[model samples]
Target: MRLRHITGSEDFVADSPYVVHRSERYRGVWNRELFPKPQPIHLEIGMGKGQFITQLAVLHPERNYVGIERYDTVLMKALRKRESAEAAGCRLENLRYLSLDARLLPEHFAENEVSKLYLNFSDPWPKARQANRRLTSQVFLDCYTKFLRKDGTLEFKTDNTGLFDYSLESIPAAGWTLLAVSRDLHRDPVLNEGNVMTEYEEKFSARGNPICKLIAAPPK
Candidate 1:
């Protein structure tokens, strides 16, 4: 999908307190410096429009949430959504955004800094040659393990069957333990509980698409 560039989006993010403009500088101190108090940090990669992360942060005030998005336009939209929520009297003190590439996660976070990671409807780099680019690929999983604490969980949800199958194979291959797997997330009585819907999840599920989900933890 070609994203339309929005004018002043970068400037907007720079001025917004909700965005961590100089994320690299905060590296190991994010939890202590950003949130009101030190708490378990949960990160969501590719947090489009901020629905899931923002809502999750609101629901779980004890945990801090950081959303990472690469595109300026999309990140801007998420910022706007957050502003709208604030306008409606929502206190989003535990939430923040980072405009950065996922590959640089290790540079911006210290080892064991993140307690949980969320991947929702990520792009399916379907072609075999592009498998390395998949978020659940072995390469990315190794990177995730660096910052994710021991026993920390990575939860993934997607509507793409091919990506789901690939993740099921890639996760364990990277030596992570698959704690739970759901081919149809919404229908899974246990996994579906407390599931926050992203914009994509709501749209696709409304069209009768079965959402695939999984939870994996680093090997002890």
Candidate 2:
């Protein structure tokens, strides 16, 4: 899908303090540089308009949070959302945003640096030829191990059943363990506890789509 480029989005992110420019320099020392002090780091990939991760940062001040998005236009929107959230008196000192591709994750984060990882409504890349492009694919799972802690859990939510079924098999085949699985997230009290809905998630749920969620962890 072609992204609709918003005018001047580039200039917006360039001037924002919330954005981490030249993020590669902070690799292996995120806590030492980006954050105030060392703490558990939670990261969200493909943070659309910054709803989920931003709320997580506000809801859990004890942990550091980072939201990554590759598109400058999308990242710009997230930056604006951060400003609005701050205006409403949200303490976001522990939150940061990065405009980078998922493939570059290792360039800005050290091995075992992330305690929790989130992949919310990522492109399923349904075509069989595009399996490797899917965020829940085994290939991507192997890439995540570079920065995710051994016990770190990855939470994925999607409305696609095919992708969820593939992920159920992909996780174990990639040598990871599935900690939890939910077919209908809103109906599952345990899994839905404290759940923060994304901008897209709300739309999908309103249409009566049964959101599927899975939590997986890398090898110990």
Candidate 3:
């Protein structure tokens, strides 16, 4: 997706206390350094506008949440949503935002540090030659193995059928196991329960687009 430069976004991200700067310094001790209490760490890659993660942070205060967005222009929007959530009387101290590339996750995190990882509607990189760029591809799955615990899991949601299908094949080929899968998540009452919708998810669902979800366990 082409991003239009948003004026002051870079400044806003730099100045926000919710944004974690020099995050590499806190690698192995993210839970110790970021939150008042040490707890399980849940990370969201490509956390677009922050709606999904902010809600997750509020709903599960026991967990430490980190959201990563590559662009300051995009992260600024998430910061505003986080602020709005706080204004509406939501507690989100356990949540923090990072303006970083997804491919660099291991550089900022230690081995077996993440408890759960979420990938939501990531760019599909549709071209066949660009398959390695998909979050579920072998390259990224290898990257994930470095930081995810033996029992840690990855949850992914997307409206793109091709991407979802690719993930279905890629994850298992990478030696991971699927715990759950739903081709139409909203139609599955069991899965839909406690599901938080991202802005794009809501828009797509409203248009009758099916949302696919999968829970994958890392190889031990």
lDDT of each: 0.93, 0.92, 0.94
What does candidate 3's lDDT look like per residue over 149-220, in tens digits? 998999999999999999999999999999999999999998899899998899999999999999999999
The residue pairs that clash in candidate 1, if any, are none
Please report the candidate that would top lDDT against the real structure. Answer: 3
Error of 3 at 135 (Å): 0.7
Error of 2 at 207 (Å): 0.7
Q: In candidate 2, what residue range of length 10 has the lowest lDDT sum?
A: 99-108
* lDDT digits (tens) for residues 41-155 of candidate 2: 9999999899998898899999999999999999998888888999999999999999888988988888999999999999989899999998888788988999999989999
Question: What C-alpha RMSD separates each model from the true structure?
Answer: 0.8, 0.9, 0.8
- For every model shown, what is its TM-score relative to the native structure? 0.98, 0.97, 0.98
Worst 10 residues of 1 by lDDT: 16-25
The digit string of per-residue lDDT tens for model 1 on 1-220 reads: 6788899998988888889977888889997788897999999999999999989987898999999999888999999998888899888999999998898999999999999999999999889999999999998999998899997999999999999999999999999999999999999999999889999999999999999999999867
lDDT of 1 at 13: 82
- Rank by lDDT (best first): 3, 1, 2
What stretches of model 1 exceed 4 Å from their correct place?
none
Residues forming the 10-long window of minimal summed lDDT in candidate 3: 30-39
lDDT of 2 at 120: 97
